[model samples]
Target: MNTSDDDLLDRAFLALADPARRRIIARLSRGPATVNELAEPFAISKQAVSKHIQVLEQAQLVTRSRDAQRRPVHLDPARLEALTAWIDRYRLVREEQFRNLDAVLSEQAASRGRQTKDPS
Candidate 1:
């Protein structure tokens, strides 16, 4: 089966959904990490961590560099930028909506107070 572009990015977000996976990405932000290094802090098995790595690899969020037997994973800045752009699109709209709602509420409250006071 062929994977679509959306499917690939969706996979990236899903991979990042787990805290452990996010931590792995965070560690990679500093530098590349071997499977063993990534598994060290987590209670899960190396296989489990490897599974998460596999997901990240599929998303292109993490790229494995061939260095002998060690296929250390590195964070892909492009993938992160894609995710940021996707999030920011909706975030800006919601922020604007909240600002508008705040203004509306303030206007309503002020009008209500004016009505409560002596009105000619």
Candidate 2:
């Protein structure tokens, strides 16, 4: 990946590292919510929830849109999809490696069995 992509992933992972921010993202996943609504489930102050939202905004994980007097935070599905795709790439590679290893081990076992049967 290029430097910009690396930076984005860095920011996004850092933003998601916080439990409160993760919770905020989870809530936003269902739909958009105003800051007050996002703050409702948390014991933290609304300001704290706002700060968490700011982190998510910086990471490009969420966007806020003006809705009359309110700015509702919306989860950025594209960014989340990018993250998932990145993870899946590595996971697919690892799984393929494991499958190759299993095939090699099976071949070795079959070779040993043939050798024993040949009595040589």
Candidate 3:
């Protein structure tokens, strides 16, 4: 894995640590949203939402663009893929181990069934 990717991943996980930011990401997952649009569902102020967006932007999880006076935010799914990739590595390992265990159990069960069978 790339060293800088690790650093970026750390930044992303840290940013995701905040409930507000995670909510923001969740909102963005549905579609892109303007700052005011993002703030509407929450009790927080637009400025507060902007701060959360800034944190996400720093983590490279969100991107922004001008839509008139609005700074619309969109999810950067590449970072999401990176995060998923990080998690998937361990998930795959665990899955592989489980599959191996399943095979061993299957073999043991088959062996026992064979021994107990009536021979003609």
Candidate 4:
């Protein structure tokens, strides 16, 4: 990945490191919500929730939209997709490695069975 992609992943992961921020993301994933709504489920102050939202905004994981008199925070699916894609890349590689190992072990077992049957 390029430097910019690395930086974006760094910020996104850092922002998601906080439980509060992650909760906020989870909430927004359902739909857009104002800061007050987002703060309702947490014990933290509204200001604290707003701060978490700010961090998410900085990370480009969320964005705010003007709707009438309310500014609701919305989750950015594109950024989340990017993160998922990055993770899946590594996951796919590991899965392939495991499959290869399984095949090798199965072949070895079959070879051992044939050797035993041959009584050699």
- TM-score, candidate 2, is 0.80
Model 3 misplaced regions, further than 4 Å: 1-3, 99-120
Worst window of 10 by summed lDDT in candidate 1? 111-120
TM-score of candidate 1 against the unseen true structure: 0.76
Model 3, residue 81: what's the lDDT? 89
lDDT of 2 by residue, 38-57 (tens): 99988989999888998899
Can you give the lDDT of residue 117 in candidate 1? 60
Superposition-based RMSD of candidate 1 using all C-alpha atoms, in angstroms: 4.7
Instruction: After superposing candidate 1 on the true structure, give the runs of residues whose Cα lies further than 4 Å from its correct spot.
Output: 98-120
Which sequence of candidate numbers ranks them by TM-score, best first? Answer: 2, 1, 4, 3
Q: For residues 1-120, could you state the per-residue lDDT of candidate 3 as single tens digits?
A: 343866888889999998889888988999999988889999989889888888798889999898788788999999988888999999999999999999999888877746456744
Please name the candidate that would achieve the greatest TM-score relative to the true structure.
2
- TM-score, cand. 4 vs. native: 0.75
Output the TM-score of candidate 3. 0.72
How does each model score on TM-score?
A: 0.76, 0.80, 0.72, 0.75
Model 1, range 1-120, lDDT digits (tens) per residue? 446879977897898899999999899999988999999999999999999999998888988889999998989889889888988999999999999999999988877856556687
1 versus 4: better TM-score goes to: 1
RMSD of each predicted structure: 4.7, 4.9, 6.8, 5.3
Candidate 4 stretches greater than 4 Å from native:
1-3, 67-69, 103-120
Q: In model 1, how large is the Cα lDDT of residue 113?
A: 50
